[model samples]
Target: MADQEETHTNGSGDNQDSPATAKKSGRTSLLDSGEDFEVLDDVDEDVDDDLPPLEDAGGHKKKSSGEEESAQAEGANVTELSAPQEEWLDVLGNGLLKKKVLEPGSGPDSKPQRGQNVTVRLRSSLADGTVVEEEPNLSFTLGDGDVIQALDLTVQLMETGEKALVETDAKYAYGALGSVTPAVPPDTALTLELELLSASDAPDLELMSPAERIQLASQKRERGNVYYQRGDYAFAVNSYSIALQITEASSKVDISPQEEEELLDVKVKCLNNMAAAQLKLDHYDAALRSCVSVLAHQPDNIKALFRKGKVLALQGEYAEAIRILKRALKLEPSSKTIHAELSKLVKKHSEQKGAEQAMYKKMLGNPADSSAQKRQAKTSWGVSWKWLFGATAVAIGGVALSVVIAARN
Candidate 1:
């Protein structure tokens, strides 16, 4: 259900506009403007090949390890085997969730942890066996809310290569507002046939190929977009943060020039989108950092500059805000959005300066009194200069008279 949420992609062009502009224009956000990465095509193709074929509801046919080894040693094709007896276990003890193990998994002790990434094949159906959803290989991090609550909880109880039929109450599945894609009615119970293909800890970016890193990062960004559209700003921020981490770490891996460019683009998108989400949450400092990260990569990115300016203005750093908005305007001179934002920022900056000046005048007593004191000081200086000039003129006149008397004698 989480994966089925709507996703908005970030666009390629710098003129696409920021989320603030989108809001003014009655558009959703900058996330709504771009092409999404085709991530489904990057999923591992060998997930189905590793699993044994599904058996009928009666049970699955099995072979002992020793028998399999012996048959392999003899070069004999072992096809038919005795069927394992069916057994259903109450997963939650409340019977709201139950699991029927069709085939036992290998490495029984290595079950998936809560945060581990798990890939599984699932077929979800209604009580009457109407298939609502079928995924050949769905990979998601456990406890990450990538899937429904029922699937997340059920997967943690299964191991690699395990195939089980899970029964879940509506409370654990889609609840009242059942899924729209599969058209599940309200309060419907789901019967899921799940095959846990593989479960592992989250991949370390340094060890992954460049393409893999980009794919994973793009998926995280896409998930963030979904969360953003759903107004889950906190989760959206978390997803974007993870994507940023992946992209940042990918720099250390050996990658082609083209891959490097793509990685940087993804990084910029994540940062810009993260800034938007953080702004929604009122995490001004974090949002400012995100925008700064984007600008560090692409200085002329109009969205980052716009968002950074907005964040700075929100934090009352109006001078820097004005500078950033002006920079963004220089990049996209004709952008009405940038123009409008710069206008607002300039006005706000002026008003803010005016308020500060007023506050200082109030702190220092009446500004009118200060002006009068300055005027009085200027008048006193003027009078002192006038008196000195008059004294000099009188002295010079007396000296001239004395000289004239001496000449007459």
Candidate 2:
């Protein structure tokens, strides 16, 4: 699965709210653009720690530096905490939030742009020194709203390998509503210790050379394969699609004949793999399109043909599926994959035929069995002529007796 930004609160405060605490009420606002916020009465009373002691919400205590290394030596999961060393500086011109850089980063020499994916490890806490979130690692694009506005803005000022402590007032933290996590109270400030692990620009096919583009596409395809193996079919589809796009873009570039051929081959493989992943995701139309793209380049590609046939079968186009699978089988007569798919299509066709026939019989009452079935049904219900004839004889005898009595009277 693609690494998603997870909200984790660090410290002893990452659990249920203590009964001694009072819930704050007011309009909560994220600390963005130096926005003004209403001050809550409980901010001082609830914040008890002079310099907050970091705790693990994962039910583990914060270990000493030496103990942490020793535990790591024994193969234990160790949570590393960064100590605050520098005074905080206002992030914006206003003093709504502050940042303290622990270590300067080296990178493109500039901060990240919005929409660029940023990978980082971070720990978040309240101003009173209670850890609210401590994530070992997470990946999120700037301006995506996947992370809180405070951290999102803070990352914009960060470079790869930079570690910094960011402090946001209650206005910027969870505002009044707090976060989805119940551990975060309303009108709480948040402090974050963040380390930028990596920053990457979006994939641009136009600027990359044919070789570079091909290599990049191959990387995407590899990433997709990993996602596919992890049962993340949707992400796998996306990864393969990125590769396909990269190759498609590379086709327009001025390149040698060999490179062009390589690009085409890569594109074909990407399309095929994308179709396979789409099939797993039940994206029938998309999978079919990928297969069609593959077939456009290599009409005799057995994988594409088989994938197309499977997609058709999933859509209940059994006849078309059979035709396509047969074509594939003829190209590679010994392919077990094609043979199995063909068998499945044939079985589906037979089952569909049987179901249709059964439905027709039910709706139209089976003309072939009409007369005999009617007779059998009558016999089963004792509605035969013999029963009618016996009733008629009894009625006649009753009528004759009644007439005789009336005449005697």
Candidate 3:
């Protein structure tokens, strides 16, 4: 499932907080725009961190980097620690919070030891307590190893409707992993709290209704995209496969055929990506199967048709290659890559389409060579960095203002 996530903008700068405005009587004051914050004092002090080196409040060590920003929407708290709170702070020297356990569960792969899945929502912070990353809501098979070890440990200890703070060094989590994280140090340690809102021990049903399966599959697809961007194409293919399976199982959505077509369109693209990535890994049969799956959903898809032609060419079915390639070219005349591929096939099968195959093959070009996907990177990529700077400024200013207000204490 594709997610239309909103883009974040921070004007011209990032990491700085929005300007703070104040009014005294009829006069307004805007001195060096910054953040205004109230220091929170009543925090739970009883927690665990066996490491003796931590210097947290009451000697709690932090498991991850970055102060937890108080995100009211996600109900996830972000706070920075002085030398004191670092005990519970498990910030990886890089930025990401190594996936920590949100609940203790069975074990990786739903092993009798790992545990079951859990539903949760988290607003995350990178180093220095920046709330730039957040999963407003998410579901994981918990101990099934869908998340890091710390989150699983924390999740298992939590009862239904229970929430607690849990942290861990990145060693047991994702370490200096660069392919997925933009600036994270490879294998860096991480820390976070598990606020359990709900826990259920339901059976894992693979035969659920198509609609429900579609929803679950979509979540997998989104997670796959996040990982794919991190250059984990294999995971992306698996996630897209799950989505295609759900769609293939059923086409009726209790709606009109027009609506069904729209849903199928989504599935077609999922199948296309699955095939593309699988081919990159040299899994020809699997790639061909995925392309066929897309045609079953929507025969008019030029991309899938083109991909199918490529698969045929790989199998040395030059005659079929020329036919499918020609069809794809008719639909997308402006595609430079498609023209390149058919040129070769037309030569392999001189009599594939009698007289026209040669002409069409030249027009289709060499179907063998694939062009890079023409997709625009998320607009937020640029905006989010600027926002980060702006937010940081505001946050620092807010901290200073709080220090001034609480000096009397």
Candidate topping lDDT: 1
Higher-scoring candidate on lDDT, 1 or 3: 1
Against the hidden true structure, what lDDT does model 1 obtain?
Answer: 0.73
| Cα lDDT listed for each candidate | 0.73, 0.67, 0.51
Query: Which pairs of residues collide in candidate 2?
Result: 8-133, 9-132, 9-133, 10-131, 10-132, 10-133, 28-176, 31-172
Write model 2 residue lDDT over 248-309, tens digit each, in one string.
Answer: 77344579999888888767766776776676667899989988988889898777787788
Candidate 1, position 200, lDDT: 85
lDDT of 3: 0.51
Q: What local lDDT score does residue 122 receive in model 2, on the 0 to 100 scale?
A: 86
Every candidate's CA RMSD: 15.5, 20.2, 34.8
> Estimated TM-score per prediction?
0.60, 0.50, 0.47
Can you write out model 1's per-residue Cα lDDT over 99-165, one digit (the tens) per residue?
7777778754667877799999999999998999999999998866566668877787677898998
Best by TM-score: 1
Error of 1 at 220 (Å): 2.1
Write out the backbone clash pairs for model 1: 10-34, 11-34
